[model samples]
Target: MSRAQPPIAVLVALSAVGPLALNMFVPSMPGLAATFAADYGTVQLTLSLYLIGLAVSQLAYGPLSDRFGRRPLMLAGIGLFLVGTLIALLAQSIGMLIVGRLVQAIGGCAGLVLSRAAVRDLFDRERSASVIATITMVMVVAPMVAPLIGGYLDQWFGWRANFWLVGAFAVVVLGFAVPLLHETNHYRQPLPGLSGMIGSYAILLRSPVYRAHIALIGFASGAFFAFLGAAPFVVIDLMGHPPSDYGRWFALGAAGYMAGNFASSRLAVRVGLCRLIQAGMGFMAAGAALMLTLALAGQMTLLALFGPMAMIAIGNGLVLPSGNAGALSVDRRRAGAASGLSGFMQMGLGAGISTLAGHLVVDSALPLAAIMAVSVAISLLAFHALRRANRQARELAARTRPALPKAA
Candidate 1:
């Protein structure tokens, strides 16, 4: 790490681009549809397509960072993101909006992947997890209140102003990142060619420990994405609340997420990663169960829906930082690649879950609750399997350790 390195707040700001972009724009979707004369599904494509672009681009940026160092590539990413944001700000049609958003996703992904990699680059695994937890807790505030700000922005300045805000934030981050960002990749490997990059991915895919962490995060995050996809329609469309109201409901859930991150930051090293993840899964299961019970009992009101969601958010905060560190731990030499791959998995699964949730087209909250429940339950199963695999690997390594022979 550089002596004059930037604070973790900078990293938090950088990593927050994805969610901030996503959440801030959500409140404006109805307005966007009205502006471009498009349908809800068409407008929603901006989010889904952006996530797809983000997933694919991060896969490449990780290795590129490993080869070129984090600073230059990150700056390039910020530049591209601004370009896309400008394009969207000036867009006159839905097609143009989606095109700009796709480009923007590819650009914004740089910060999201690199920020996590930067933490791993600078700190030990345990401390990295704690720092990540703290960063996430703070960064989450972006998504937490973004819709509120964005709602007012839409009402006052029009939807294009949301992109303007995104651009402004990126510019500020770039200013700081240039002056204070440090290079953490001490061992510079030559940038891999196509085949070499594939080989690197192959190696990560072969690690059971790495894959387990990926699976756990993928499903845990999927549940949240499913909610993000469905909530606008549920709250604004079905329940007939204004877009501004969704922001208030979302904050309650975000508070839960923030609480969990606080706990993870405080207890990650002492409680250990695996235990924290397990406890998080337990929280998820409990929340999902509560949601399911309410839905089945015909109590599928707004409180019934989002209240339980807060609990799941809490679990995600606990599991995600620990999971990211665990995945990177399995391949410290390739922390960039691991972080990218895991992020891709998280977003890719999120995209799929959200897409499905959209297509479900439910008149009630029961369907959404059911999907979230199932998703979290599956995440729990993945964690247990990972736990067992880790235990076996540890025992095998212990047995294979070289005997001390006779004391010299």
Candidate 2:
């Protein structure tokens, strides 16, 4: 086996790229709009398009990594990301900027998908979950500080500086990847044709264990994306916080998520993956329910909003690592397909929820809270279904196993 190169550090570096790529440009959104002379709605398309690119491209990256190997794909993706950053930096129009963002996303999705696959490559469920949690604990800082850093950059050197910074970051990651990262997909064999790829995915989809875990993670992720899409508008536009204050609020929620990840890392080994996920879903549900109630009562102040929001963030952090690790644990031989399918479902659901929440955003916090409640409730249901499936699997295995000899 290739030496596992400190999974926690690898994950931290990989996870950092995703949020940094997205959030570093968020503070510059208004400025970008003004520069392009576009409406706010049009400018928001940059974010939407990035998510679209990320979701769609992840499917290709996962299987390709499986077919070819992880290190080469990762290195090439980083190169592509750097190129995209350069394009964004030099873009003179909104359309060009959007194109660059899309390209960046295509490359960024590699880091996300492969990181999970790599974890699954090296570890089992509980250990993988712990590794993911530790990574999340460190990586959560990206979102917390990205906007703050972006804001300063926007104020100082204009929006193009953000892209330049991203380019530099990409180079740094590439440097690390060259020496530290190694191919971990020992089971992966070269596919001879399209039919082989299709068969791989089909086999993964047919597995009940994989489906349950993927669904749980997908819905749980949707809840967080719903919050992310709606929170800025609710906080800044409805709640009267200045745009500049958004970084602080974003940091608060990220801090809560970081705390949750830390807790999950510590607890997953002892509590078991299923129990930890169950507890997390319960917390998420409770938090969402409380937020919904407060919004309905018209008592959703900043403090009221962030308090329950923190709970949801924490719960999601706890659940995601376990859910992903469980899904990937089902088939070591097809971990890449499992990782691809799970990434597709997770990002697809996230995109849908973000879009729905964005459209449902009204003049109040009610819509956002309601969306979060629904997402969390769905995730809770998914977790229960997974539990039921696990029980059935255990029973089936018991029935199929040979009976022990009467005398030893």
Candidate 3:
């Protein structure tokens, strides 16, 4: 209702900002190194430290949002982001640039965490999943376009221009979002003492349902990350394709992600979360299965690599949205906390998977294929376990129902 923007558009923009912040400057890395006369290892801290800051700040924002409302805290985060971007734009040394990036990450994460929490706040689980999928679909476009944009910006204006652009974007989004963002946390949980906060997290950690859902997301997406890590090697070395050809194939794989998101947005409301998850896992399993088959059979072709991965990408698109929404729904008062923790697991596990995939590719494409397949298989098992747990809990509740109606 605010004159700035609608809720959905705002969510889309908020979600998009995190990815843009994370990747938009990647193409500028070489230019950055040359500008500061630093080695690649030193310059890489700009990314690694940013990730560390991102992971840490997301954890803090969740519980803080529970105490405060989403709007003020998110606004504060934007303020921090803008301040950091300004610092980066003016940075005269590599250390200063790295510091700026770290601060930027601390604030940039607010959008990724809060937007998911806000979705749960505003909608039911299934609907939340559908909307989140839509937001995620839109957000993917940013990463796809970001590098190209960064490439041009670096060519035309140098690396500093990228930071300037990010700062401008922050200002624009802040102006647009201020009036539209409602405080969606209807139930203000009392500021927890340390012990109480620990107890809350303890309960969530103890939940088999929560753990299972988290694991499903962790490994399901892990397969995709594995593929991403291995793809360049497979395309350039194993399959004898050029880097540009890999880029084209990567775009096709990304299209598969878009396709899956489109399917989830259309079908999640109609078929429900469990069935949709099942279908997604099926796609993943089939894709992964084909990858292994090709590798084992010594085909080792580019089609074998990219074709099936596109399918896996599609599956992750479906699972990530639904799984994330469902995880947050299990703990309503702690949606912010839940979203943050789940995100941490997904990111942490994804990093691990990508690293392992890199190591596993030393010998042949077979190891990459094997690791990806195994990761998806693990996710399928976790999902089925969670589904079984849900059924058992429902049956137990039914059995415990009182017979007072007979007396009446």
Candidate 4:
């Protein structure tokens, strides 16, 4: 409960753990299935269940942090992540590995939810957007290199090495966090148990502007998820490219996203969140149009697939931070809940869109491009709807708010 806030580097480190752990083990999935003598569907549970855990856990963490504190929940989350890593490292069956991953996700997402909440607690909306963009831009490197490191580890020492490395990382973060991390939620509210927590969420959900922000965040990120799910098959299967090519070209998408985040970090305070969001949706629309146009033209090259995806990534970078900052600003007292709800929607929608893309992208990349296009369209609509609602709300407030007395 110290007055000092955690440093940006510490916040970045805390946030990176979740995404790093999520991607690092991906290269080991096939090998893991072989080792466990399990079917592909069963082995895939490790990932799908992890996503479920991340989404569900955020719902609980937000309200709990509002009631308890951020620092303690953060420490507990990292501790659980380490414990889960240990469990995965020693797993004897696919079932055990699946369970470990779920646990890891539950713990890791605490950082994802609380880090934003902490930023919201400490700063106003625009500044919070700037800080969040900076944090995201820095931490983007974690997922960018995760699969590369995981590939090497899985090739050299087997999949267990991935868990060992992640566990060590968790330990280091926990060590630094124990003394450095302080409670950022200065205004802790009372929750009369489960019903009260639900009521807090209900209050947030009742706000049209809040729901609009969530839609903007969810659908915007869902475009990226759809690409992640289907782009691999379109690149490797339909285009007849090597698996390595997919990884190589994927870097372009990551770089574009990083660039966009860096732009947001620098421009959020100056350009304003709403304008940035509109510009972001513009980029996404252009990207999706390019993707679909190329697919329909019978051009299935790697560039045709990843090039537009890179543009969409850039849009995602712009939208996510601004949308999150807006959502968190809705009700400062329930900032934690707002952050958590937004994260949940983002994850849940991404999961659904990605899964659907996976099933539909069998023959061509057209389906993938279409899905991205639709997702971006929805996000743009949400952004406009939110803007209109804000104007109306302002008008109402201006009419109702009392005028100041003329006496000086």
* TM per prediction: 0.97, 0.93, 0.84, 0.93
- Candidates ranked by lDDT: 1, 4, 2, 3
lDDT of each: 0.87, 0.80, 0.78, 0.86
Residue 155 of model 2 has an lDDT of 73
lDDT of 4 by residue, 296-371 (tens): 9988888898899899889888988999999999999999888888888888887788777767777888899899
Worst 10 residues of 3 by lDDT: 1-10
Per-residue lDDT, model 4, residue 73, is 90
lDDT minimum window of 10 residues, candidate 4: 240-249
What shift in Å separates residue 274 of candidate 1 from its native position after superposition? 0.8
List the pairs of residues colliding in candidate 1. none
For residue 346, model 1's alpha carbon misses the true position, in angstroms, by: 0.4
Predicted candidate 3 versus true structure: per-residue lDDT over 1-408, tens digit per residue: 522324877777766676687666755654455689986556656765675676677767887888887777788888898888988888999999989998898888888888889888888988999989898888777765665566567767788887888788888989888988777876777766667666777778887788888999989988876765556556655666544455556656677888888888888899998888998999899999998999899877767788998899889888888899888988887998888778777766765776577556765789888999889999999999889877886888799998566654
The C-alpha stretches of model 3 lying farther than 4 A from their native spots are 1-6, 25-49, 86-98, 151-162, 227-249, 292-305, 358-368
Name the better of 1 and 4 by lDDT. 1
Indicate the residue-level lDDT of 123 in model 2: 77
- Please tell me which predicted candidate would have the highest TM-score against the true structure: 1
TM-score, candidate 4, is 0.93
> What's the lDDT for residue 131 in model 2?
84
The prediction achieving the highest lDDT against the true structure is 1
Candidate 3 backbone clash number: 0
The number of residue pairs in model 4 that clash at the backbone is 0
Off by over 4 Å in 1: 1-4
